[model samples]
Target chain A: MRTRHPFTLLTLAAALPTLAWLLPAPAGALGTAAVAFGLAAAAGVRRVLVPAVVTAAPFWLFLFVLHDLPTTLAIGLRITTMVAGFVWLAAVLAPDRLVEAMVARGWSVTVAYVFAATLSAVPLFRARARRIVEAQRCRGLSPRGSVAKRLRALRALALPLLLSALHEVDERALALETRGLRSGARRTPLAPPPDPALERAARWALLLVCIAALVGRLV
Target chain B: MNPLTLEGVEFHYPATEAPALRDVSLAVAAGEIVALVGKVGAGASTLLLVAADLAPRITGGRLTGTVRRRARSGIVLPTPWTQLSGMAFTVWDEVAFGPANLGWPGREIARHVERALERLEIAALAERDPATLSGGEVQRVILAGILAMDPDVVLLDEPTAELDPAGARALWRLVRVLAGEGKAIVVATSDLDAVPAVADRVAWLEQGAVRAMGAPDLLAEEATCEAGLGTTVAGVWRAAGLAAPYPLTVADAIQRWR
Candidate 1:
């Protein structure tokens, strides 16, 4: 499933949330949420499942506080469907495959690059942040001191990482240039994750099913 | 044509009080390995960045001089940890990143990636997660990544900084093999002992300037010793007052003793 087309996975992820919103509450919302969670479990994105449920749990509590029980269940399930669907997508979707899929399908390389780079920058920054914290601790600049001292430690930790990572933007640009990622050039995907014909059919089917259900609910 | 050339090149990083490199002129033809030796702040890295076109082009610095690159180039910066393509999960994929980005066909990408793995003697590591690699393994992986790009000129900044002695020896041999294959190679390194055996020429940089450029035997020069740029054997021989011509390697020192 992880190896499936990125757009196909995206379609399923997006459809689950849309259907939950379009359909009548409680029963319909619960159904979509169930399917999304099931998909998440099946995909083995165990890292995200607990967080997705925990994240939705707060919303349920808030909704119940502001509304009656039935209404709370209705709105809360819709929100849960929206949240869990995306969380699962984030867990399963590798950014590189997304970029490759986008470029392989004739999308602009710059757009794919921006999306992939942004997705990847998070983990890269997080890893660097950890290193900086460790290095600062070794240097005896305690981050556990008073607020002002902690703030200074943060500044010390942040400045080098920000400068280094910012400098990487330029280096990455040059790296991209050398790789023939010149604007508008169609980069051949060394291994564009297999987007089988069935997956394309499934993707379109997902979109149409969402539209049909939306009409069914409205009418 | 020189595979890589820099003539009268000077560079100053933006907002800096002083230039990082000045009056650095050098040429590297295909089949030649040029090494830059100096202390931590000796402008060796700066000169490499200039040669790799990172100083002025990507680094936001002022460069005044001629830089002629006759072919495509790849740079392997010092920190292998920072240079990784964060998206790659496996070592194979990491090495393939450059060729994949270059839009090579899938089969061709695989070919290049595998060959690079073999060359770097990391074929067994192709399946390992890059995040789990040791410092030396990471260094080799980074070199493999750059080499898979098939560049005509390779610029390496402190390429062996994190390697074990054996790994460093392998890397130096790889450099020679690359040069034999007609790729011009420029390396900025602190490993003076390996310079005599690996480098065809050496440029001594000091305080952001190329102070001297000559054959690898320049390591035996009294001037190099005075500047703290002498190879280990040469420095030790000079300290012992062995002879006027200091030996740059252990073998040479033995011959001198005989």
Candidate 2:
């Protein structure tokens, strides 16, 4: 009985629909940015918040000009909750643990692996992008250039990042194979997360609550 | 038993007219270290891939001849970032990726992973995020990951390509230690100066074929110079009007200076 970061993911998932229902349309955008920041923070990726906020600024401004304050706030809250939920899960739930959980719950290992790989791809891409940016900087590419020049520098980053990623896909496939990620085999998990009775009860309760809320809203 | 034997192997990549490697034959005895050196794209990487059973198996290409590995092989490719276990948050988990995949017991995985981190001098960074490490640190972490698997035959493609001088020295020291512990190691690298001390033998790959192979002295030969595949030290020594018995490393040069 292995429970994997039950509190974090459960709390986040429970908060999503509530935020969605309570937030107004215009504020929804701001709420989303807040969520993104919150989630990033929860994921121990507080560094991403500055960038995320900057990126979402234009959208926030647009909403502010077009919508009422309550609507904008509601929407903002919704977004923040959703992002926070996902970020929390990403931070506390190891991809391997998630994969094991899915497999233990009768999902195919292939499906579990795909889900796990998708989850891991984000950090991988981010790491690669940083390397490419550093390499470009070493080659005298200005990080603070004109819009077009910056775009060009970004393009340089993109090419190598994508090429390396594609190249690594092959290596990853081989690595996975060597690790016995083959189909039709009942693979033994190295260390399954604890499945505490209290966690199981909480998970089920959360699921039921979410379903009930959805049904009540529809009715 | 020889850990690896590549016999008359040839490989042609898809849509490429020239073969990436041709008629390359080499062997690595158990507990030996063999370093492969030449210019970039001279086929060193391809040779390692072939030895790791990844070239024809994973890369779409036409491969010929026999490539036999006597022991389980693990490869740490050139780009350390690409080799990262994305699912891992902490460096400790990243290094444990390969061993956990092999379904080792938790205790065993922990033991090997701790040993690997210690050997790579990254134990302090164990709880740190792998994605946030510097290039040299990331390279060490990748090496730690592979070494944790306890592969009897390890193949590294430009393992120290991203490392600084100190980091490179540390990796070479670990290479020697692994060999001492009876792991057959094949490393493809451009760091020829470190080869003489780290490698028991050297293989010169030219346009995907074995141009020459023997002791580290082979890299300092007139034949290597004629082939345009002489190492940096050898090239410098040759340009300095040095005669036979040329030095392959700074230590050798210092010794000869006296």
Candidate 3:
């Protein structure tokens, strides 16, 4: 499962959610959710399954609080399928592999770079945000107070990260330039993840399953 | 063409009144390693950025100078973590990032990446995740990333700030090896003791300008000592009132004592 091509894994993950939303609620949602969980299991259940369930649990709680049980169950299950599927995908699909597959398949290098860079920026920003929080805490910035105080603390925690991240744009641009990422410059993929025939077939099969489900529901 | 040349160069960061660099003029030849030393906010890092052609071009600053650079340049900035291409999973891929972006052939990229990893003594870490590396390891990885590009000139801003003593020594050796390979290298650092053994020339920066530039022994001069740019050995010698021309390094100090 870990060796499956990133695109193939992505396609399966997306198709599951699409089918869950398009098909009838209750029964259809339950089946799609099962498939999503199965995929999560394949992506290392210890890492993926727990996260998917925990992340989707809040949505279910909110839905139930805002509406009746029947409506909540239907909408909550659909959202769970979508959320779990993406969590599984994120667990298995390495951004670098996806970028390599894109570049190898004749996609624009800049497009691949943008895709990978934006995806990776989340973790970088998260790490920096954590550091800023710790630094502020050490400086006697009380995080628990009135609304205004909390807001001020939030500003303190967020302001430096914002300014430094913005300043990092110039540094990133310089780093990119030195790496020869000029306009129209083609990039060479070293150790591009192999896209075997089986993975391609699996990707097509996932798309077909989604299409078939949609057609059956319409008919 | 000379590897690097800067003539009457002055720079001001956008939205700032005072310039970050003033009347800076210097040149670096192939096979030379020049070190920039100064107090905090002395613009040593800024000077290296300008040398790497990253100052006004990427930093958005006003510059007036006749700058000439003959060969390609790469810079490893102060913070290695910020410079990391976070997408890379392994140390090998991190090192290969620069060459891969250059569109070199796969074999060529692999060759350069492998050599760079070996050069930085990170070959054992080739398969390790870069995110898990320690501060010293990250600095070495960043150096490998820049070196893998095979640029003709390399600029490093405090490359060893995060390294341990042993790691610092290894880095200085790598710098000498790079210069020996005929690649012009410019480094801005606060490591005074290592400069004499590694840097061929030292530029003492003060207030965004080159106050003095001369041999590695320039760090032993009285004026440089007054600015707190002197080597530890020189400072100790002068404090003891031992001699007029103080030693630049411990080896020279030992010779003088003998």
Error of 3 at A97 (Å): 2.0
DockQ of each two-chain model: 0.41, 0.29, 0.63
lDDT of 1 by residue, B180-215 (tens): 999999999889999999999999988988888899
True contacts kept of each: 0.35, 0.28, 0.62
| Best of the candidates, DockQ | 3
Judging by DockQ, tell me the better candidate of 2 and 3.
Answer: 3
TM-score to true structure, per model: 0.88, 0.74, 0.90
Instruction: List iRMS for all predictions.
Output: 2.8, 2.8, 1.5
lDDT of 3 by residue, B1-258 (tens): 688999999999989999899999999999999999999999998888888888888788799988899999999988777677865778998888888878889999889998999988899999998888998899899889988998899999999999999989988988898899999999998999889999989999989998889899999999888777899999988888887798888888889888
Reference-based lDDT, residue A205, model 1: 92
Q: Once model 2 is optimally superposed onto the true structure by TM-score, how far is the C-alpha of residue A215 displaced, in angstroms?
A: 6.4
lDDT (Cα, tens digit) per residue for candidate 2, span B2-74: 9899888989987899999999989899889999988888999888888888787777799988888879988
lDDT of each model, Cα atoms only?
0.83, 0.75, 0.86
Off by over 4 Å in 3: A42-73, A131-144, A201-219
Would you give the TM-score of chain B in model 2?
0.94
